[model samples]
Target: MSKRINSPDTEADITLRTYLDIYPHVCFNMIAGAGSGKTTSLIKALSHIVQNHGAKLKMRGQHVACITYTEIAAREIWDDVGNSPLIDVSTIHSFLWKIIRPFQKDIKDWVIERVGEKIKEREERINRSGTRATTKEKLRKEINKLNRQANAVEKVPFFNYGTGSSYDNGILGHDDIIKMAVSYLNSSEVLRKIIGQKYPYIFVDESQDTFPEIVEALSLVRITNGDRFCLGFFGDPMQKIYPSGIGDLPGDREWKIIKKPENFRCSKEVLDVINNIRRTGDGLEQTQGNKTVGSARIFVLPLVDEQQRTEYLRKVQEKCVSISDDQLWLADGHVKILVLVHRMAAKRLKFPKLFAAMNDNAPLSFKNGLTDGSAWPLAFFLKFVLPLATTKLKGDNTMVMRMLRAHSPRLNKEQLKGTEVRQALEQLKVGLDMLVKQLGDGSQSTVLDVLNTLKNTDMVKLDERLIRYMEGNAEETDELEDDEEGKEALSMQNFFAVPAVEFWGYLKYYNNQSPFATQQGVKGAQFDRVITILDDDEGKHAQFSYDKYFGLKELSTDDSKNVKEGKDYVIPRTRRLFYVSCSRAKKHLVVIYYTADVEKAIMNIKRMKIFPEEQIFKVEDLN
Candidate 1:
């Protein structure tokens, strides 16, 4: 049974189709609000292209490219499009890589240039920091490692994508692929023509978070190719979360901004709050597509300790159940409690110290790596060590052998009789045994111990970034405040041991497999009832101060200056995140604020007018 309504064409669908009817493609940006059937609209657009231009595209050997943000989203679009031969659906990374991967020589040159820039950055860091031998030694290895790769790029036969970088093997990392593609597209008119010819029409979902450089490059393609190539962006700028994204469309007079002002997901109450919060920024109001009843409020609380926070969460669930008249809100996994950081949920999951060690007050980029299994050490464990160790411990030799055969390097199945292949297989098994002995118990083994065993066994080749971190070198992120000194690498010894089983729970939370999710993680996700827990003290990042955002405290001196200069980042970003969190509720939304000044917060809540006075409640009332 399809949940999609067999409704008539929305003005957006009609407008887009009418434009598609034209000969030369007119690139336009669609402002699709949350729960507004953005994907449905995108799917319709894809179908329209196939129906209208399918024959011509097939004749020219061209295809419609649908670029999605997440692999999950890409798969959904792929399936939704019926796996059409004339249409290609892939993630932004995969899509860009596909178009640009053929230019091996260009890739080599780009990578070398990029690595040289990194080397320069590292040398400058060493010059700034004086006389720290351990740090200098680590930097030396990094410099050497990078120099080797840069010098070795030309000898590589062909570059590959989707895998982490191995300069020796010609595989590029995620950032490298995207950055190289963007760079090539910007620099080469010939490349742009080739891309436009190959992908006559391209649609990028979640375009708000697409890198600004990529957005501009695509816009250039659209402009240069003029009617030959059409590019469509389907996203809401108000929902943008990452600081690095292009929140708004390129300010070009030629580009059209098509507004999809419909909300089919949130109920009337939820819609009202979203519209109000949004009005403070761009002031685009959403018309509720569903006429269902719902509740939304800004719940106020004084700064709370761990125990109080636990009790408050329970009470909020109870409140949601009573208010929404849905008993399911109390049901496990039925409601969502979105915190501002992984550490908050990590505390509840009993890995607070481990999470805190790596993540507390860390830049968002660093935290993203650890939580999402992108950071090298974490990736090593989850991808290589854990699967083999667990299968061995369970005595699942079939699974173990299969994993070993699948992942062990230099295993050529066709040449199984060869001594080299046989030795590699035996070595992998030995390595797996050593790994299981060291960390299988999930106790007393430091991260460094597990890493060394994995590296020694060649279970998997560690990423260069991981090598740098292990060498007491942490990569700096964009969010590093200007005044702060360079961050110290997280202590490998003090960081929690690989309790693999417990780590799954943490990973699940990151993937939104658990009821507890971070606010940013649930960008395109919604639930029946949602409780967004916000605390300035607990968030610990200088970037997001919900207190300053909601007028509980004054904006920092720089924040005010940024606003005056029309370069404000904090307030607008906070507003966008707040809007995103609040908009994710179908029946109810409880935005809990742990603030120092309840009176001021309450007063500001009234001024904001996003919530009804009666709906807002204190923690004591929840009791």
Candidate 2:
């Protein structure tokens, strides 16, 4: 159940209502902290528009555009609005794609040019490797394959780009779409005017996550028309976790500030803990006065002796288990143990890994696993595609068919039942093995080479739809234009040139059941209790550091220097990530840090009263 509720209008709510009533004439930036009812306020503003200004909007053929940061957010807005055509709710990517897809000819031309450039770059690399007979043969072989792949005279109608799993997606990668959208809006006045007229009132939720370029594009429309269009920027600067983020408010122009400091999620006690971490907190208030006061502590997990550290972690885990007892909170979900790390593959945490084992092989696994918490496409790839592709193992016909059926939307069940399809797959696997073998003994092979061999195979008739899988094309999203046969195949070909082993290794790395989740993945989610494991590990993105947030070090200077000069400066991203992790708990928040000078840092922090001494515990002390 949600901790927040629809109550009487607060000071922030009244201000938002007043500002939105005068929208298009008055631009406002709602600086809402975590769990400040930003979504509810957004919904309320839209509901207001639907009730009061619906007729005017309907007559003018315009709608209020609410652009969210994620698909989940978009859905929540949709559910709240309940099938209102006057309300345009979509993720920034979806909204931007809708605007840019119409100008797809330009995008198509751009993709072909990019592909051509890649081919040229590959050729140059091959040339530079060596002039040996083997090198020449390899180069010639690769060039011929490239020529065959690039043989089509016509344009690429649909190309897969973004990292998402929507099939044969339309032209332009998500980044490209944003860039192209910015370019198109800059050059085309009529289109911008049309868009401005279409969505005169624009509300951007979680505006901090939006790329500056994308924001500028939308801002351009509003700027060109001059107050004829209104854009409400709603987000918390403290929660700006993305590295590329430029903070929540619009950089293009100034606006009236509206602060929503009432945190409806966590209790005042929890807020106090969050506030202490960031000196700039807005002193947010809890929604319910009777809400339970959650415990917040910082545990210093010292890495004293290399061997003893393992035992220390075991004790720490056991203590965490006791702290996260199920009887303590009424929340239904399992306690989330958040491990802050530089990289999932680079840093090792045992708890989450222990539970990673699951047989994702059955036919219904992909579908069921989605509801049960596995990423659909990745799970499908791991269970079906990767296993079969890596080995010459047979009798996995259903897995191939299921994967092909999923990725290739046009492939019917009857198509999978065909004996020719099975024979082709069997032959394809054999051919793949031979290709890998030929590249033998210290020779490296690219993902593209493997995919290309499948594309060129002759044993079984290949469906153009299933060709993407054979080709290791992941970007073939659902937005791709259908061929004369009305079929689409989304491919991840951009990942093709990557070394096959490395690609598989990354997947193997991802195929884990660790209870620990990166702070970014679980930011919006709430847990009964959260155990955040912080460490200063090498290869971790320097942007997120616990030392800076814990008041052990300054947030600026070194981190800022590292970013600007590309030197060994502290990571600035850690600030927001730490802030986000601290705020994710509804009941208890435990921060465990492993630092180099742990004893000194702990002593300094305790002396400075950074955290309550009673709440702070040493790893050994817990035992």
Candidate 3:
């Protein structure tokens, strides 16, 4: 009674066929690069289950459980499987939470009992006298420390603090989701049965990004149900860009490894560049032939001082403007600009200008940041305060207070008033509270009034442009439509549209940490161009070790001695980092330095040999 579809003539089709032929409660790991039809393969496999196996077993259904790392990805899969009679897809977090929420008491009791014992030990350290530490302070420190340790150990890998109960429920974050899912699978027979009845085919998209806990959870589902459930994982090992993602996949024995390395997203020239960089090592060689080809180039800018930096950025801006205008007539072809920083200071200094044009637009379509970095306090104000000003309680003090509390949760109301950030926070909080109260009370005109007020402010004007630009984008509209089903499935707004204000505010105060602070934040993300600003300061270079550079092919070995010896041996880790940064760009790679030290830059090029001298661009020389 399930609908079936024929496999198209694509790599996904070939991969799915191999999966069907074996059909052994199977785990197939399909490695494919971005835009290389990995999702298509997943779809094909799900369709095959509907056609070949649906109705053969009583428990099995056509519903395909598709898991991804981020909400964005989950939405994408939902869109792909939209209204399909034969399939149902969701992010693993959303899926597990849905099943577990009904059993909240059970889960809460289990987690609290376990975590409570640890909390008690920490509480004991503080004297019973109300003198030692407050309950919130104690809880905050202990929870943050436990979460960090859990993430470090890979036991609890993904934890986001913002958004909702799923992230901030004190028991579940990204890593906790996996642990809880695995625990549920181990203990709950009825739950397993329900999941089995709902979904027989488990297709984990971006499997390379999945941690061991997730794998264990999926494995349990398969084991509990036996032949009724089939597990299919799709990802490219080479593209396992996150540090935690390295060597995460099960070996060939436990799972069938299917290689799908056709380069569908890039040009031949681009593929060549990737291959050339990848082939420099001994153990690492191109397995799947490069099927993608495109024009790839590296642009190196010599670092001088602040003056030179400004001039360099100006020139780059001009180039971007030119490209944007030109691309209006042609396909923009996924242009991304990656600005790599050796330190936090460089990132703060360089990123504002690089993204100024886009950020200035209405409905701000472009976002820039370090992988897993903290949200900017200023950005939060821009997003939340203006909207809030439109409400009945339109006092500047309330707006500032809300903004402060939202951005910095560690401070209490008393502390909020005393702190230097007090004035700003008060204004923002008052404005926001007014806006929310007015909106909730159905005061549309009041909301418009706040908007008018904000229109006069600098932040409000920027947000207005951002709003306008967002409304004008056809692609965003399409993506919004595609994500509608996923939004409904998650019973939330499109995750991306969940206002950066609320999201970042929740993260800052409740979560008290940035998800970007970890490795998982940057996974599956890229830029059309990249600018790496290396810190030549002492002790910083040590951070660029082989282990730190897992995204590049060169970091697979111990070559620290060669690098230290100054034998012109590029630090494999540094090279890999450079490679990862460069690869993030779909078109161009830009390197910016400020030391006037062309020696280091020259040495790097000679050692890595990633690009010729002609490809390097001197920013000072540019018109």
Candidate 4:
């Protein structure tokens, strides 16, 4: 076991020390600010527990449950602390699946009932589409497939279709599992007791962003049995960016709330602007000090004429380039462009072109993105697996190759210098083309047939990561992930029966043409210099109004403010979105307003003294 962590630099660190000193008796909440050292603080807390009380907990058969917000966060914590049986670190889905998996019969029944309702509704819709010659055959096939799925539920009694699979695979789409777990715990007193006996400490990271149902269920467990375990919640209320935030989460007078209000990521200059805009920025200090001097600037662009708008765009591009060349910045400066809308990054900022330029000419290349640890696997499915599994005559080899080069560290341009690997990929491409012909149109071949054909070929390297992508870990595989899972013990026919369009939709989500990302996409990520573009012309901004935050407008007396005080808030999603974007920058932040009356808003903000005079700029000045 590691030694108890001992680093007390700030008041927050001291607060953490005080909480952990009491150990298993206190139910505490850590209220952190944006850019604060929450991750570091969490690591310290975990380390203290592991080094000091881990052995005792293990002796008692009670372990710590550290629940993170996402898989990436879980992996990060696991990497930092190293894997330990005394502690269980995982996302909410993974953690819940373990607790709920034992009650598969109850869950399966619940899932089947839900699926049956959906299938019935779909059948009605298909029938309503009319029996036209063009649509009749397709509708008939769909109905048959749904009927087959419905029938399979009885044969495969322990199945879950909610996770894009025939059974719960301990990965993806955990909403159903969470609901079922809540229901099961509410009904079964024995199961709750069993859980309480096993886990003595429950730590929820990013608790502000936790789902309402999950929070409610956890609170139910605590309230029902108050003396069971110590539950610790840690997150910033300002950072609650999701739809169902911790506003409805269970908390009362007994739970002690501690504040960690130090800005470790940003400088005082950046914090000044942030403090001015933030609703609860009292006593928030930048701990970075003289370490990193950061700058914040707001640019108001002209929208009167086409010529002025064109010039404004030109200046913005120049500034982006200049920011890249600036010495004070760190990392790839070009990667720092943030947009209000995903489309704005592609349309106004030309992010696709920027990425293409970077990949074509830069010293380094961008990596292929992943969503829920399934990017490369899905890409592999689309490229090699799908065509072989389905009756599709042709495959997009170019797109497949692009995904390969982007994501795989071993399959880059540098690695392609050798003729052997290049020839192998080319041979594999040829093998894929020929296999489509061998399978033929309407050929009755399973996914295993494709695997069998390519298993021994010289084109496929046994040691390559592609194998992992093609064949995921059997322990973690479900019906969608591994079609052959159905055939193993259930004796089900055509277990991997995903529709072509349905599969494509999953793949298309991660494989976007542009490099520009949304606020939600770039959370928990930091950049050297961030240039955020604000515009609502695409109609993607929804009901989020920037005018109120920018000081141009006030909260109308008639309008109901959703924001809650202290514990949680029901404020505009736009406020959280802006906070997320602004907090990402380490050294420099440039926010561009692309509205018609941009000058008025800028003047209003200046009058309010939200931004210093030197930090505000006009687009015309840049030109």
Best candidate, lDDT: 1
lDDT of 4 by residue, 333-448 (tens): 34466666444443343233322221222111011222332333244555655544343344555665564455444455565676768675766566556556445445454444
**Cα deviation of 382 in candidate 2 (Å)?**
7.3
What does the lDDT come to for candidate 4?
Answer: 0.58
Clashes of each: 0, 31, 49, 1
Order of candidate numbers by TM-score, starting with the best: 1, 2, 4, 3
lDDT for each residue of candidate 1 in 1-623, tens digit (9 for 90 to 100): 12232355688988988887777667788998888888888888888888788999999999998989877788887777778999899888888888887777778888788778878877877788573776666666667767876778868888887334556568776767777888888888998888888988989999999998888888888867888888889999998988878898766666677899999999999999999999988888889898888888778999878898888878877877676678887888878888887777787776665575456554333455665666444666667666677779899988987776676554556746657777877887787777776764455665667677667776666766566666654443212232011222433324434443455555565556678887887887888789898898988867788987887777888988888898746789888988888888997888899999898889888888989999889876786
Residue 426 lDDT (model 2): 68
Q: Please, what is the TM-score per model?
A: 0.85, 0.70, 0.58, 0.69
Give the alpha carbon lDDT tens digit for every residue of 1-623 in model 2. Answer: 12222455668777877876774567778877776677777777788778888999999998999998767778877888776999999977678777766655666665555556646755775678455666555445544544554554233456544432222234233445565677778888888888888888989988887777777777778777777877788888778877666564544445778877677677666777666655534334334332777777777875555456546655665675677553533223345666654244223532121122221121222222322234333443455445555443455667655554454423444655658666656666566565555333443665556455544554223444346555444232222222111111222222333444443443533543444466776656777677776765532445566666455666576566666775333433565677788788877777777776677778866775646888778855775
Residues 1-623, candidate 3: write the lDDT tens digits. 11213324465576567666575566667766544556667766665665566556435333666777666666665565544565656666676776676665565555555455555655565545563345546444655544553343344323333221222224354345556667878778777877876777778777765666667766777777777567778876544544444334756476677766554444454555555565553224333233432334443455455565656655664554464453421223233333333123223323222222222221211222222221232343345653344323455656554554454433344544546455544554454455454434333332234443344322233343234333442222222111221122222112223222232232232232321111122345454443444434311434353213322224323455656664323343344444444444444444444333455555565565555565555454456
Full-model lDDT, candidate 2: 0.60
Model 3 TM-score relative to the real fold = 0.58
Compare the candidates by TM-score and give the number of the best one.
1
Model 4: what TM-score?
0.69
lDDT of each: 0.76, 0.60, 0.47, 0.58
Residue 564, candidate 2: alpha-carbon lDDT: 79
Give the CA lDDT, 0 to 100, for residue 203 in model 2: 92
